[model samples]
Target chain A: MSEFVEQLALCVERGKVNRESLYPPDLHGQDGTDELAKQALEQGLKPDTILEGCILGMDRIGAKFSENKAFVPELLMAAKAMTAAMTHLKPFFQSGAVKRKGTFVIGTVAGDLHDIGKNLVAMVVEGGGFEVIDLGTNVTTAKFLASIEEHPGCSVGMSALLTTTMVNMEGTIKAIKEKYPETLVLVGGAPVTKQYADKIGADGYSPDPQGAVAILNKKVA
Target chain B: MTSFERLQNRMVGNPVDRPPNFDIMMQFATRHIDKPLRDYYLDHRVLVQANMAMLNDFQLDIVQAISDPYREAFDLGLEVSFPEQSLPISTSPLLREPSDLARLTTVDPVNGRRMHDRLEAIRLFREKVGGCTPIMGWVEGALAEAADLRGVSTLMLDLFERPDWVIELLEFCCEQAILFARAQMAAGADIIGLGDAVASQVSPAWYRLYALPYERRIFQAVKNSGGIARLHICGDTTLILHEMATSGADIVDIDWMVDYQKAAEISDNDGPAICGNFDPVKIMLQGSPEQVREAVINCLSIGGDKNLSAAGCEIPINTPYSNLHAQTAALSEYYSMA
Candidate 1:
């Protein structure tokens, strides 16, 4: 990694939110992701290089979470730190300078009002440089279709926490496939299983936010 | 041996004629018998009748009065939305900002809407069948109650953004839970059921820091209040099983995703009994009677006869009657032979 990019990645890994924030116990009172990203940009680091660093840091955290070395709280801290850095690269993204790998549209399927899992996936995926369109909770099939129409060629993810609402995932998957046969759909939740995903005809199923990132990366890479 | 004797014996880890079966029932099913959701939770008569229905209808060994986690949250002044036949959910969430804690007041269990309702239910259960069946009182574990108070999203963020605030909130919730558990024991609950489903969402480290201490405190409080404590977390808790076993509960109810054999291995302590690992949906809600029997047999095989029972989480509200019979039938067959 480039020296500037490596510094950016370290800031994210350590959850250095900004120059002013005091956290992580170890890194208190130090320059954080915000200052490092700005410095990287001023030093003429390419936007893609900075973006790659964020992705690498996020991936490392994701793997740690999957392995049980880190928890949701730590992952959220990393994601927050990555978001802080990404803010510096926003202008580049807007000006067509840094391109996102693909678009991912996600929501908690109809009848399920829970959004924690869905929101976590959205945050982690956004950190991975994907244009994420979050539809929020209790999303109906019609609403999902509308999102797909608005962002054509976007991959879709459906989530449900309640067992009763999990049935709605099947309906949403069917509706999306019938209307847009080519659109890839993913499903997940506490009650959702790989078997249920296969039975529902979804293209993928991830048990955790990191798994979702891996699936999205494989699809768009 | 009678179901009551069997369960009592198992509770102390004494040798039983055979393993007993216990299941946590959902309050939403009370609506099927014409009781409103809130009324079923509030009225002692309604709570007793509903639980009695479960015992008489399914021959369950233990009966519990559990409504929803939103009860404490609602009494804490959070807005809650209650559907006709579903669990009540908090609308506003308690932890919008760290400063919101100062504005929040602790609810007295006697005067609180949700806690009082649960207490009334426990009282009714004791009056109706105190000696015949074990009655379980319910409280949300610190993590789950905190999630209900703080929206799940904000709590997840707080875990990252504000570690100190998370610790403070969990401590406050634990203090409240001890008070709640004491009141329930006074109202005649034999066992206190601690619901901490949200803890399953976090990794083991977060669970160890934010959940385990509070759970141990609550469990110790329940025991000190002259009631046995049962911990019921509804999700895949495999990752945190070992830590959870150390919470000092008398019974640990395992959800569908956790293998009972794995839980038994992790629980290493001999005091707390392991209660379940069946998939309520697959076997109880939508399976044939034979399949249900087979599933119970499988669960029992994995759980073993010592300090084990039948159930996963809250038995699904819409589980088929015949499938439920199959669960009892399997239990009866096993115990009768023993």
Candidate 2:
């Protein structure tokens, strides 16, 4: 990696968004991922290089999260940092100068309003260089199918916090499989288990956000 | 001995046959009475009837009137959405802005709409079950209530950015918690279940500084009012076990993520009496009776005499009846051996 990419990656890993951001107090008054990514671009650094830096940083944090070495706040801060870098790259993506890895549509399933878990997964996956289409909470099976149609060949992730709503995962998974048999369906949440995932014919299940990124990466790879 | 005596005796170090089993059950109880969950939770009469019926059928020890965490927030002038088939959720936080705390006022449990509903549930439980069963009243702890009033994500970031705002919200929460718990005591609740499930989101150090002090105040109020306090924290709490023990509660209800071995070590024979540590979904809801028996036996050995048997958190509504019975049925196996 180039010097600029390495610095941007370090900023994302340390959750430094910009000099004005206050989350990681030790990094205060420092140029964060937002500033460094823009500077790197201004200096003619490749957009792909900056994106790879984000992927590298998110991979490190995602692995840590799966090991329970990191908590929600750390992951959120890291995602925010990645978002800062991604904002500078968005114009490149729209101008066809950059290519996204793939689309991953995610949502908290019907009758379940909780979104923190789903939001975390979306952020980490986005930082992994995927274009994430997040359909917010209380999403029904029809909404999921529509999202899949909007982003064909996209991997789908469903979350449900309540045990009552977890049962809905089965129908959602089955419907997606019925419509797009080749599409991957991922299920997770507080009440979701590997056994339940297998029972519902889900392609994968991850207890944490990092694991979700790993699974989505694997299936697409 | 009555269920109340069994628990009360355990509280004061009196010998009891075994540790009493107390669980927070609303969805599970509604399944027993065949009422829609919304119906059961909306009316104190339905909530009381469904709980008593579940206690009798499951052979559990407590008749608890605990519902969702949105009750107190609802009474504080926040709109709570009631889905016909799911638990009630707060649609928007009561304190969206820091200055909004000025508009907030302490709620009178006897006259407040949702708080009064819970009080009536307790009084009705007292009338019907009397001293035969221990009745528990539910109150959201400072951190949990603050999260509800200001939205969870907002409150979490506030802890890092605007901590003063979080503290002020918590102080306001303590005001409502005292009134809620005290009214339940006057209405004949044997214990107060202080729920701060969101504390699991932060590290033990953060919990100690931001969450624990306010919890200590609420527990002190409960103890002063002659009502025992039970601290219930849901989700993975392995890191915060020691800090959680300092809340001055009589019992700490743990979740599955913290096994009984960790609970035993954290308690160190000095912490609050420990109850639960079983996976509500995996062990009680989906597992067979034999699996339930095995888990109970394992928990008993790990807990020794200071443990109570319960699901890690709220018992799921879809949990099997045989699995529920096995929790109590296996207790006999442990008692006979001892």
Candidate 3:
């Protein structure tokens, strides 16, 4: 762990996006994840190593979130910081010089407009090394099926905050299974239960984002 | 004793004849009226009809002026869309820019469309149920109102990126809550409910710092206005139980994720009298009548024999009439033994 990588990890964990982005006042005016990642690449640190830093940062925060030691704001900030760092690695990923884990396509089910949970899961999954195609909130079943068709091997995820909208997960899962039975579908939200997942025929359910990451890894692995 | 007398007695930790039942129901009421659920929000007449019908049918306590959370945002002059079959959506968030906060004006609840609709509901509830039943007026707390006005994501980031602006926004919304509570209380609301569901999203530290003080202020203001305050935060609020207890509310509605018995223990029966903590969806909606009765009994023992019986939150409308009736059986059966 060199200075820059350590600094980058620290930045991601504390949610410092750039030198001027003053979130964690302790590191105010310090080079954040964005600057540190760029400097690391310039200093000949491999893109994979920098990405490992991002993953490490996310894992630390994600684990804390699982333990209830961190809440949505902290996890969200870390994700924002991770995104800042990932911007530097995007070109390498595009050029095939960097690789990613499997894709995870996620959304809030139709008639449910909440994206906070879906966004949190997407960020954590992306940090876990998956290429996340976030379909955003109020996503219809047709949109989900079309996304799965476009990304044949992608694992599907859906979220719903409202109890009224949670039932839609059942229909969406059934529709997906009808078209692509082999595709894995995951469901979660405040209202969703493992029992409900079992009832709905969803392949998996995770209460927290890191748990979602672990489930995605199991499927991909 | 009537249900209102039991609730009034229980508010101060007095021994009631039996525990009183108090849960919010929109779905069950919607089914009773045979109208679109959307009508409940759009028409105060329909809202009152549904509420009165549920209370009359189930013999439940609390004639409430509660509806969706966005009514305050709508009253604040943000354009809100009511989808025919879906929840209301605020088309434009009020806090697009920090400057937008300054441009905002206070909402006169009597004059604002949705606020007046709720005021009308409160007046109607009072006229219908009056002194016989406890009537509750609802208001969204700072976090919920802030999220409504300032998009939730933006509000989340603002906590870190724009702390000063977040406070200002919250303070603005706090005043909004105070205004809403004041108006509702003056309009014959016996118990004013402050629903800050998003308070659970922040850490206990953040909640204590940013959210709790404002909540205390709102509750205090409600008290000054001669109104009882009810605090309801809609998630697992285990970590902040002690702080919630200190907010000067007459009752705090616990969610299903938390153990009501545990909450009463943690607060030493000194916290606002605990209401709720039952799984509305599971017990009231999905459970058989026997299960609902057993649940109420379980709550009585766990919450130390003196608390209001409320669902973990709101009961879904589709819950069977038998299960809803079973909610009342808990109280009657307990009294029968006494």
Candidate 4:
């Protein structure tokens, strides 16, 4: 059972989607997350155990990505493999056999339509076993407020790629904080920094999606 | 010395009156001067005035005519969303399938709305400056233009799922970029700036296989058309700096995450001037004038004496005017002593 969990975790880390998937060159034709995860489940592994394995794999990949040992392409592949395995476990989650730690609300701020950064964060956060509420790009402060209201205790993350729309982050941050002071808000993007995050009263800032997951994990923990 | 001479000297690896302080000006800044975004990007006069404001107000060395990445993508018939006071975005990607390439038409730079607008901006700048300051004409790099045509997510998938299709699309983008480069050169642009912000997202292997060839083609196109090429790939490009330098561009614009010294060592030459490596938000938007100056000094030291210019990525529109002033002041102070 422990060996199956370890293999599932390694599959997620290396991004092996299925037995036939040829990605990661070295892992070509090997049993992927799909087979390993199903085996784990058929062997009576709990849903929580499967989720814990995923979290462990994603945490490792995210940290490696943040430190520059891994790039976006690698992370995307890992996320894809993780998603394939998670699909099998979805039934368990839907039946209330397993519960996600918390919800995360995220979007690129208004006037900024870029979504790659936001999407990456959403994917990594979701792989970390959190319920992600993606608002898409060009999201206004009102939209974010509504999302926060819907999720209640959920944390929010705002992204901006353009220099112009980064200013709008400040307004969105202010509105969310004013309406829900207890709700945590994280900020990031190409033009964002820790200083700007602090200046705008955002609770956290991460340079990459892995950092964002780390911050979210810490907040939830 | 005149700004033109100062820029020329800096570009050629010589000491100048000061380091060249430049920014890839955005249409969002036009709101500060009360011009609508669409009108500013369309009208050469409005674009020039906005860029002039950036130079005059901030002492920028080169006044750029970069409005957004949509111009080339738009000409290729990609659906785009235009918003007020923000860059226009590609709404629907142009390429839906690999076979769709046969139906796509190449846009002549002189005939298209956005490309023509950019060309006119360069022409007007040449007429206005005429050796007073260097004017930069803009083009989208192949991968970035391809992403605009195929949607970023789809393109990333295409790299692995359909490598041949990615190559075909990139070829089209490169051919169009060469044509665009020629038109800007004809319009008297001293330097052609290629914006490929999306290239940073790919792995170095994919970059070497897909992006590098097209970059080399575009760089050669600019040089053959009698203009210098300045390649700007926004984001963390540290992994591919060695591959990037071999593309033969005259200048490379480093984003905030790449270290200047590393880029210099990888380029293995002094004349391929590097423009940036500062965090636009931390040092330009949020930092004090003193901090901005310190950042500039750090960039200069890391870049060494070989014709290094100063800028973070694109300067933030809301960056304090004093922060910019301090940047230029530091350049002048450093150069004067050198």
- Given candidate 3, what's the lDDT at residue B256? 91
Q: Indicate the docking level reached by candidate 4.
A: medium
Q: Among the candidates, what TM-score does chain A have in each?
A: 0.96, 0.96, 0.95, 0.95
Q: Write model 2 residue lDDT over A1-221, tens digit each, in one string.
A: 67777778788877888989886788889899988888888988788998999998988888877777766766777888899989999899989898888999999999899998999899999988899999999999999999999998899999999998899888988899899999988888998999999999999999988888888888768
- Real contacts retained, model 1: 0.47
- TM per candidate: 0.93, 0.96, 0.97, 0.92
Model 2 off-target regions past 4 Å?
B12-15
Cα lDDT tens digits, model 1, B54-146, are 778777777777777777777888888777655565667666888998787778899997788888888888888887888888889999888
Q: Could you arrange the candidates by lDDT from highest to lowest?
A: 3, 2, 4, 1
| Segments of candidate 1 deviating more than 4 angstroms | B15-18, B31-46, B266-269, B336-338
Q: What's the lDDT for candidate 3?
A: 0.86
By the TM-score metric, which is better: model 1 or model 3?
3
lDDT by residue for model 4 (B224-333), tens: 88788888898889898888878888788888788777887754454477778777777887889999888888888787655455565766767787887788888888
Q: Give every prediction's interface RMSD.
A: 2.4, 1.6, 1.2, 2.0
lDDT per residue, candidate 3, A1-221, as tens digits?
76666767778888989999877998899888988888888989899888888888998999999998999999999999999999999999999888888889999999998788999999999999989999988999999999999998889999998778989999999999999999989999988889889999999999999999998888768
lDDT, candidate 3, B1-338, per-residue tens? 87688888877767777788788877668768897878988898998898888777888788887889888898787778887767787766778887888888878787889998999988888888888898899889888899999888788889999899889888989998999899998889989999998899899999997889999999998999988889999889999998898888888889999967678865464556888777877787668999998987787667755578888898876788888778787778877875
Best by TM-score: 3
Which has the higher DockQ value, candidate number 2 or candidate number 4?
Answer: 2
In the predicted model 1, the residue pairs found to clash are B94-B149
What candidate 4 gets wrong by more than 4 Å, as runs, is A25-31, A35-45, B28-32, B266-271
